[model samples]
Structure formats: structure tokens, C-alpha cells
Target: MRDNEKDLSWWQTFKSVGAAFFGVQSSTNHKQDFNKGKPVQFILVGLVAVILFVMSLVLAVTFVMPA
Candidate 1:
């Protein structure tokens, strides 16, 4: 029934809500790539990126009017 008691109750509810929004759970497993398989993934991604860059360069050069 007191004003100070109401304020303290409000603060506790706010903190509990904030904690639910931001707390980290230790039971969840994080997704990870195994190092043994990483080199192949790296090479594949690199090759695809390089191919895209080269194709873009070719298209730009082919469409530009001669100066």
C-alpha cells in the first residue's frame, strides 16, 4: 500500500523482464565447423568469389563503348 514499496516492486519486475531478454543459457550448444573440414570450405568459398568477380569484370568490359 506504500509508495516506496510500489517503486521497489516495479524495479524488481523491470529487472526480471530485462534479464529474460538478455540472459545467456549454458545448455545450448553453439554451432561450429570442425577444423579438419575447414580448408575445403575455405577453398570453395574463395573459388566462387573469384569466379563472380571475373565474370563481373568481363561483363563490364564487354558493354562499355570504346572511348
Candidate 2:
């Protein structure tokens, strides 16, 4: 946590977005995200995470349900 480094890394962005998805993001993190994150990048990452989540659920259901 260096003062010179003000923005989150890609992995940190992903973690922030994931916490947001679960509606449990801390206020401090939210503030940091708003201050340091790029909107388009966050949007793109969020979309990708949502799509992957849906795809995984579909695959799991396909595999588990009696056919």
C-alpha cells in the first residue's frame, strides 16, 4: 500500500467487482473503487464475470439434472 500507487491492480478490481456482486462490499472499498477505478474497465470486467457465472451455473445444471 504505497502512497505513490493510487489505483487498484487488475486482480483487486476483480475482487471488488465480485464483492459487489454479492452485495457485501465494504464502504471503504467502494470509495476506493470509485476514486481509483476506470468505469469502462470495471463495467467490462463485471459483464465478463456475470457471463461466466451464468455459464457455469448452466453447465452445472446440465450435468446434475436427470436427463
Candidate 3:
């Protein structure tokens, strides 16, 4: 590993994933993620986030629409 690269914690990974979802991740963080983050961890978190987002949209539509 490079001197600047270190393993990312779960919280850091989560935040990085969230930032990516919103397309607002900084270049520094992006580089860090690529350097230090695990691909499997990012994939799993992204999948979960997508599922939660879809579920929330479904729930909102269900509640907002007439029966």
C-alpha cells in the first residue's frame, strides 16, 4: 500500500458510498476510496442503499396515492 493509503473503516465506507450515490464525492475522497476501500464493501453498501431508496419511494407513493 502507498504511504497515503490506509484501510477504510465501515463508517468511512458508508459515507463514501452515500456521497457517491449523490454524485457529490470530492476528488480526494474518490481517490481515497479507490486506493483504500474494498470493492465488495462498496458494492454491498450500494445495493443496500438502492434497495432502501426504492422501498422508500414505493412507500411514499403508496401513502400519497388514493386507495
Candidate 4:
């Protein structure tokens, strides 16, 4: 990271990851994340998001299907 580039905050990291999940991240933000965000943070958040998504899908199916 450059001296002028600050580290990404938790909210910024979350938004960036969320945008990436939807494939709607802007080029500017993508560059910023690449340049300033920590890989571990992004990876951790992405994993958590994926797990939540999977859990939500399971719950939805469980509710909609005749168990």
C-alpha cells in the first residue's frame, strides 16, 4: 500500500466484498481494494458471507419444502 493510501475500514471491506459477490464492484473501488485492503480480511469476510448465504438458502428450502 502506498503511503497516501489508508487501510480499508471494516465497513468498506464489507461493502467491497458484497459488491464483488454481486459482480457489481466499480473499477475505482476494485482498485482501491486491491491496493489497500488486506487479503486475510477480505478472505475472512468472503468466507463468512458465503457461509451465511448457504445457510439462508438451506433455511429457505427447509421452509418451502414439505419436510
Best by TM-score: 4
Error at 9, model 4, angstroms: 0.7
The digit string of per-residue lDDT tens for model 2 on 1-67 reads 4467577788889999999999999999998998888788798889999999999999999999999
For each candidate in turn, the TM-score is 0.42, 0.84, 0.90, 0.94
Q: Which candidate gets the maximum lDDT versus the true structure? A: 4
- Tens digits of lDDT, candidate 1, 1-67: 3334322233333333343335531232111122122344445554665687789998899889575
Better of 3 and 4 by TM-score: 4
Pick the winner on lDDT between candidates 2 and 3. 3
TM-score of 1: 0.42
Worst 10 residues of 2 by lDDT: 1-10
**lDDT (tens digit, per residue) of candidate 4 on 1-67:** 6698789998899999999999999999998998899999999999999999999999999999996
lDDT leaderboard ranking: 4, 3, 2, 1
The alpha-carbon lDDT assigned to residue 14 of candidate 2 equals 96
Better structure of 2 and 4 per TM-score = 4
Better of 2 and 4 by lDDT: 4
**What TM-score does candidate 3 reach?**
0.90
Off by over 4 Å in 3: 3-5
Q: Against the true structure, candidate 2 has what lDDT?
A: 0.90
RMSD of each: 20.1, 2.9, 1.6, 0.8
